[model samples]
Target: MDTTHRKKNEQNNHPRKGITEFDSNRATLRGKNIFPPFYVKTTVPLQEALKNGEVRNNTHLLVIERNAQILALLTQQMNYHHVAQGEIAGEPWMVSL
Candidate 1:
């Protein structure tokens, strides 16, 4: 019997047939809730951010400019969130780090 067919039959007979098998070699985590994407709901002005100590002179930023409008996000914040989304120039935009 073919190995692929044998494996398929084995999976079908298993109780967790519908669930995906984990592959450590490839580091696949199909069902794991790791690194969920973050959504940006609101934004603060640069002055307010500065006043709140959210931004510093040396803080790195990811900036996007479109249709004369600009959007900026802190790199440190993005590092943990992994993904962020916002609107720019009336269009939807997404950024991933």
Candidate 2:
């Protein structure tokens, strides 16, 4: 794969904006407008997320993701605390203490 050509090719390309389906168990909230090459998923409990500041005071969902695509994933959103770990689908939790 040519890195320069690839980068140039994607310079004008744009991802279709939309939320992925959960039925596939690979739901990805597209970051089309802001970060077209990125997406997110969350499955952690809402409170755990708040403690880690993964979501705001009013977030209702946590989207988690697996290791599949070469994409940028934002696990948590916070100023100081970020405790999210890489979680793969159908696999055991990889984080310990």
Candidate 3:
């Protein structure tokens, strides 16, 4: 058999590891907002916050603070493949991370 063909076959037979690598390097806590914080009405519109740098992709845990008081704890899983196979019912801005 040809060397190139043998290599291709080997690659095809190997089990791919995508999630393991992503989980290892992915962020686990909210560092800082890239943009100035602004009050927005809807959570679904929050994608603009991420894009415009108001909220950061680096933020794994979100805290809603108002007037120096802690409001809530946001425990979120921002994995890339979290919603892989489902079609979104509404037109929410998607962050294709």
Q: Which prediction has the highest TM-score against the true structure?
A: 1
Separately for all candidates shown, the number of backbone clashes (residues 3 or more apart, or on different chains) is 0, 6, 1
Scored by lDDT, the top model is 1
Off by over 4 Å in 2: 1-35, 39-45, 60-97
Q: lDDT tens digits, residues 1-97, model 2? A: 6999888677657463343554554566665433222212455555665799876765543344445522222333421223334435544333211
List model 3 lDDT by residue over 1-97, tens digit each: 9999999889877777233455545566557544333322234345666688855767664444444433222234333222211113332222222
List the candidate numbers ranked by TM-score, top first: 1, 2, 3
lDDT of candidate 1 over 12-63, digit per residue (tens):
8997567677757766658855777767778888788888998987889998
- All candidates' TM-scores? 0.62, 0.21, 0.20
Q: Give the TM-score of candidate 2.
A: 0.21
**Each prediction's Cα RMSD?**
9.9, 17.9, 14.8
List clashing residue pairs in candidate 2. Answer: 41-63, 41-64, 42-62, 42-63, 42-64, 43-64
Error of 2 at 15 (Å): 28
